[model samples]
Target: MMSGLSRSCAVGLLAAATLLTATACGSGTADTSAAPGGGKPEVVAAFYPLQWLTEQVGGSDAQVTVLTAPGVEPHDLELGIPQVTEIKSAALTVYVKGVQPAVDDAVDPAKSFDAATAVTTIPAGEHAGEEHAAGEEEHAHEVSYDPHIWLDPSRLATVATKLGERLAAADPAHAQGYRDRAARTAAALGALDQEFAQGLSACRTKTLVTAHEAFGYLADRYRLKQVGITLDPETEPSPTRLSEVAKLARAEGVTTIFTESLVSPKVAEVLASQVGAKTAVLDPLESKPSGDYVSAMRDNLKTLQTALGCTA
Candidate 1:
């Protein structure tokens, strides 16, 4: 009954309105189980990376929420009332185990919820390397293999596969959708892996020094060296420690000193000054921006490449 252009415009408007309504209601209630008579399945992811992974596997069919926001230190965060409420209401809660011991203390594993996915064990030791200082209480948590398993492309695919299965089991009607999304996410992660391999293959200095020991997993997966980490992940190093690291940096010929956003770079800066090198900020998956998993990994790869002086 209307002109062609007018009809198209009307359809576009209707679609936009529908999308707006859905968005306003929030994507946190997209579970297939939550149909007319069924309730929505709410998902709570502990951190940004996991949240991104779950959302990719669940797509628009499940409502996914991330408790940790950008620039916040996941390991040191404590849950507030709002966050606890969100977790309590979620049908499924996904978290990278051991990365945040504080979280484990806050939530009861048996009583919090019936379905919880602790993706990787805390203090995951798989990639921590053998050089971890002896009798260091700090490394105690690093025993679980590497909580940062998401950094490994192959491992990330495994995670996506697992998440797909879990999501499908939780909501059978959208099982195929979850599977497809997982496959797509896996492919994207594979491409990211290739990019990192190619980009860092020819780095002049493979040794990395950082504010925290967080990069142990990344360095191990990429075959890079981690020279040392600051004593405290959050605090500034003492003058004695700073001088020691500076001497170590110069002795090792380290070109760049890396620090994360959530931690102070004072010690790293001192070390860099002593060694006449530069300082760069690296995100250790403590928090992530709004982009999807692949995009965030790509950004991290770029930062690492620049810091390491990789050719590609």
Candidate 2:
């Protein structure tokens, strides 16, 4: 019933309002540098491992963006508007559900592969030092299950298979390439698993003392016992707790203290000094983009072998 002129004016106003709303939402200091669009399907990984696996499978067929930066701890990340926008626009998002709550909020569930659901998960801090493992789940703990699935090469190989299927589905033109790449990576991982099993067959000690509960999956995979200094990586241990850990380290005959690359080494240094032990780096492969997961994990295997005195 409205006049054409009036309809034209209404449409103009609606378009202008939409523009304003979009502009407001996307305004100011937004990271547009790695915004995902360049003909190839864009993939966004919640953390580094996903990014690496995607890169390996995607192989010039997809553009990948890793949300967590190198050397930063991913436990307490808050996604800004820029990252949220990136997630929404990405063609495929690969993430471990419950790892980063903010990333969960930003990604469309229907459009993502929640890798936590893709693989088996053990209780978080389940193998952490006895003092911290109370079979309790709290809001502050953030995630119920450990999100460090990538630490286990076999599990990562499994994920790579699933992810390859997803990638082939997304870009059918390069489907064979994705499958081929994934198979190669999966084979390499299988060999790594064999190596861990064989290499760890004759270790003098099987107990692992770690900076946090990050190594539970790796330890569990290789049949090693794990003890962690703290449940939360970012939290500073109270003086009392620190002393207790030192005492426990000595009592348990924990000879090698392991520190995470992302966290400070002070705690490990102090504990090692207390227990008359040496400190080593055991990367969790979460935020470290500079090091690929396989290579870092290989380095971790070497460190474990040396620290645990694995023979043959």
- Deviating ranges (above 4 Å) for candidate 1: 1-38, 106-144, 235-244, 290-292
Candidate 1, TM-score vs. the true structure? 0.75
Worst 10 residues of 1 by lDDT: 110-119
* Residues 186-259 of candidate 1: C-alpha lDDT, one tens digit per residue: 88887877888898899877878877656665677688876555433643345555666677677777888987
Per-residue lDDT over 126-200 for candidate 2, one digit per residue giving the tens place of the 0 to 100 score: 433333543234334357788888888889899888889888887777789899998988898899898888888
Regions of candidate 2 where Cα sits further than 4 Å from its true position: 1-37, 127-141, 238-244
The superposed Cα distance between candidate 2 and the true structure at residue 77, in angstroms, equals 2.0
- Local accuracy by lDDT, each model: 0.68, 0.78
Root-mean-square deviation of each candidate, in angstroms? Answer: 10.4, 6.3
